[model samples]
Target: MSFQQNLQSKLQGHLSQIDGRFANVKLLDQFETNTKLPRSYAVIGFVGFYLLLTFLNIGGIGQLLSNIAGFVIPGYLSLKALNTATKDDDEDLLIYWVVFAVLNIVEFWSKTILYWVPFYWLIKTGFLLYLSLPQFGGAKFIYYSFLKPVTDKHLFHESKPASKVN
Candidate 1:
């Protein structure tokens, strides 16, 4: 198994022995769901971090540009989510897009110590929860976009039927 899967397996084993094993499982499941969901905070975090890096300008236009970029990546990711024929894909993508768009709007216009500090704390805390969760659903989006396509192609190649000899 891959390093991450091995680590997750070991961690799950250890966690299952803890006092509140079931609770931990439920929580991890929730987290995994969230991570897999399209346009979720993981994607937002990546895009937001990128925008912050790219923009050094302390102006309205810079803020607008960043917000636009943030919207595009997550939105695109959400769109790509439709490729998954799984049952939960639609709901997950919906949740992600809605939350992501709303939060991105707030983050975009936030300025000064008053808005920035508390909002930063709030978003940061949410992000921390996201990161701390054992299984984040948002991870699925990454896996699907980057890994699943290749894996699927390998697993299910296009085939042709053979003619019957009558």
Candidate 2:
């Protein structure tokens, strides 16, 4: 086979593998069927907690929660993704959360300007709601459209070895 044809065949195979891996990731369906608690209850609880953080202005509790939401939980989910054989919806969610967390951290560092913005907390809270609520499929969309392309390119590169000099 020509080099071009062989490379094209390999690329197609990799694309097929990625498609097969993500074919069964129905985020909304998984959220509906897999959880023991109702989705509304979870949403209410999260909103309530956020309200408390904002209204009461507790010491470091808000920061702690932000850390958990942005980093700890997402890191756990990413680890879970690595361990699972199927790489299900959680994997997609993790990608979204991790990217969001990184961006949030960058924003956090610029709190002086961000704090002056009107309804900043409200906007951030809404974004968090969209991310955590599987019904929105925000995470799934991000995973498939943005993260997957970049990640797949790196993955393909990593799988191939460098040529050795004679």
Candidate 3:
């Protein structure tokens, strides 16, 4: 029932869960496989496309052009990640592509309609930014700060001492 005992109990439970999760697999084993050049190559791929787009002046192509480029950027990255066996890197890329593709399709088809407010573009931009930020690990930090303590306590209550048994 003491505070120290409660803390120890909680830590032990967490260690047990972590142990179970990684008992058969080493999460760090793949860390060494990521070489520098391949990583740089991925970056180069994005930069190349960006440079080409800048010179081609595709920005004037209107909504259809914007939609295609938006989807292509993430879509290309997603495929590249998969080809390289980068699961963690690909997760965000895949999600971004999906969102971009959907938005692109919707915008491309809805141009003729006039009911929607022009602020729809601003709203869409905000939603896209919100969705993409968490993939960079911001959400994990927020959740740990706000929910970890309460969750840790609920998932693991303090154990009674052997001497306390009747």
Highest lDDT against the true fold, candidate? 2
Q: Is candidate 1 or candidate 2 better by TM-score?
A: 2
TM-score of 2: 0.44
lDDT of 1 by residue, 1-78 (tens): 999999999876654454244344454457557766422334346656755643443443444454454455556656
> Could you tell me how far off, in angstroms, the CA of residue 15 lies in candidate 3 after the best superposition?
46
TM-score for every candidate vs. truth?
0.32, 0.44, 0.31
Model 3, 30-136: lDDT tens per residue? 43245423233344465566445533445443333334445554556556777885577666665455555555676678875324554343344344444445345
Global lDDT of each candidate: 0.51, 0.62, 0.51
* lDDT of prediction 3: 0.51
Candidate 1, RMSD to the unseen true structure = 18.9
**Sort by lDDT, top down from the best:** 2, 3, 1
Q: After best superposition, candidate 1 residue 140: deviation in angstroms? A: 12
User: Which scores greater on TM-score, model 2 or model 3?
Assistant: 2
